[model samples]
Target: MAPTIPGFDYQRVQVADGIALNTAVGGSGSPIVLLHGFPQTHLMWRHVAAALAADHTVICPDLRGYGASDKPADPDGVSYAKRTMAADVVALARALGHERFALAGHDRGALVAMRAGLDHPAAITLLACLDVLPTLDMWQVLRGTSATVGFHLYLMAQPPGLPEQLIAAAPDAFFGHFLDIWSQRPEAITPDVRAAYLDACRAAVPSIVADYRASAGIDVAHDQADRDAGNQLRMPVTVLQQDWGALLGFDARALWSAWAPDLAHTTVNCGHFMAEEAPEQITAELRKLMAR
Candidate 1:
């Protein structure tokens, strides 16, 4: 079973766009929104959220498609764009009575958080991204051998139906591969936790595919436009990433610095799932960022 974090309560809140998002909220001070990555839910933040709850209101939400949130049918062209998803986070926080809040996201959530900071700078007081670069930078950096390391991206980026169908056929193996490979310490993800992740992915295939599909298309367009406009995150931005691209001969900090002008890029010794693999270190970085 996944290790339980004490004192956190789960609840659902209705946002303006007719979507009801299941959110796990705890603590009681300035609001800090925590967004989870792909194949996981608000539950991924369970350990780290409790630590933040002591001095801040930590709000963790399963981004629209991945967890207990309303999983709607994917529209023909535009539904799963990260920009649109970012808007959901914005409205959800406002509905929860936070006009201005700090934002943080991991993996897929990190993409949405990037959009939130870019599109709604006035609303986000601080921005923290865990283990990902901007989508455009990611695509630009993809090369021969380095690209192979992230084969899942290409698999998911395929033209719709194929990925969903194949993944649906063997959901456990499909999602479990990421859980096994991304973590340096596989023992951290107990069998039950793996099962829960597989279950979430099995139920969320179409939406998840739509998310990746959008990333390959519209999401790329949006990021490119931001680059063209010379836009950078105006708020204090912190990024933590493992050395995935270092082997590809790219400097992670230099690439990230190009996108986020007010940025503090650092290397964390954890694996891809930094929050889960090293919750204490993740929590410590979060505390330090909050202080700034």
Candidate 2:
């Protein structure tokens, strides 16, 4: 059985043609949509969702190609692009009767949230991105030895066939690598949760690869066009990330400032899986963002 968020109801929401996102809706008051990251599902928001349920309607959804969402194999990688995924999120929120909502995302979901903020500024009142840089800056910072930490990004960005075959061969190990190496508190992700993520990734190998591949190709083009056009996220934005800037020798705040005019960027003292390793802090920061 899939892990359930307390007091939340699960449903499959069709955001695009033949593409439905498996979503969890709970709480009341102002709506806030939370998007989960790679190799995981909405179950990752269990703790934070319950905490925010007291005053906010929390909508947690698996990205279109992850978790229980429909996995469409688009060879061109267009279907899984963050822009399309962002549209899915907006449609999902609108389908739930929310024309405007606060948005928050972690890891891969952060990429989606960023695009949504850029593309549908009217729909997202406030945006919070956790543990990821913008797509363009992300690729820019990855060079030489730094790229080593992001081997999976390059691997999946390949011509498709090989990454799917290799990951499919040992899905658990491939997916579990992030769970093991990225978490400050691995125990926060119980065995059942780990198994659930692995199972989801195993079943959606092609779609997952296509999603990442799009990042290196079409997603970059979209982001670059936005940059060249001087298009920015015209909303109050908050970003929470580990202090990787110190290690990577780049100015995180300076990078984000170009995209968000109204920005609050902070480096958290947690692992990449901040939502799990430090739920209390993540919850507090999100609540603060929504309040703003």
Candidate 3:
């Protein structure tokens, strides 16, 4: 039940990594890649990407493991690190023939984009992070009562077999729980949309688990290495987040500025799923970020 959106051409482009990325392209101008968050696909960017396509060539692709992309086996022999995921974006943009482009991502995608900016600074002209904090700082802030808000962090962080076993036993309940709690306007996610999302989650359980599991282990090592190297985004950064003060009890803007020196942070009264909940606001921020 994908929404019948007008003027989008579904496409698949093969990158150097031997994975063909399933992407949707629309509009016509400078390329701006849009990456989706956890438990969602490029469909999450359908509204915002379509809106931006009026002027900018918007590229919405499912990240490697999540949607219609190749879900290769996760052996430690191959890297499942977000750094490698970031490199996938680099390879993807290069494969699409864009040398320098504007990039943006939400939730888990934001983490990948952040790594892209730090790792491949010259390749990105602008960066936008929607509704996420740095992984390391986020872990630090998850102490005391605030920790309860992100119980899934620990749930997904556990060693392999147990989490996968439990979550697979009740995939809908596991994914649906987040879809239910994360949105301020859960009503925005109609039955059809919810069903589609749950279906994608159920299909990609091991990859999804591996992605989060990396965040808990390998990704943390990467973040700490960057921190040790005194690295930062080093580009104009825009952050849009729902005010989580009542829930997480941390100042979003203050924490963000520490990582991004040239930053513009705005708090929107949306849910954790801000892109779908407030597409207009998110688009406005993207336009402004591009103009900056």
What TM-score would every model get versus the actual structure? 0.96, 0.98, 0.95
CA shift of 7, model 1, Å: 1.7
- Measured with C-alpha atoms, the lDDT of residue 129 in candidate 3 is 96
lDDT of 2 by residue, 161-195 (tens): 89999999998899999899998889999998888
Query: lDDT (0-100) at residue 152 of candidate 1?
Result: 80
Give each model's whole-structure lDDT. 0.86, 0.92, 0.85
List ranges where model 1 is wrong by over 4 Å. 1-5
lDDT of 3 by residue, 1-292 (tens): 4652358888787754567778888889998999989788888887898899999988888888887877766778135578888888888888778998999999999999998999999999999999898888888788897698788888878877888889999999999999988899998777777787788889888888888888888888888998898888899999998877557778888878877999999988988888889999999999999999
- Candidates 1 and 3 compared: the better one by TM-score is 1
Q: Quick one: best lDDT, which candidate? A: 2
Lowest-sum lDDT 10-residue window in model 1: 1-10
Per-residue lDDT over 24-139 for candidate 1, one digit per residue giving the tens place of the 0 to 100 score: 88899999999999777777887899888999999888788887788777766577798888988999899889999999999999999999999999999999999987898888
Could you give me the TM-score of model 3 versus the true structure?
0.95
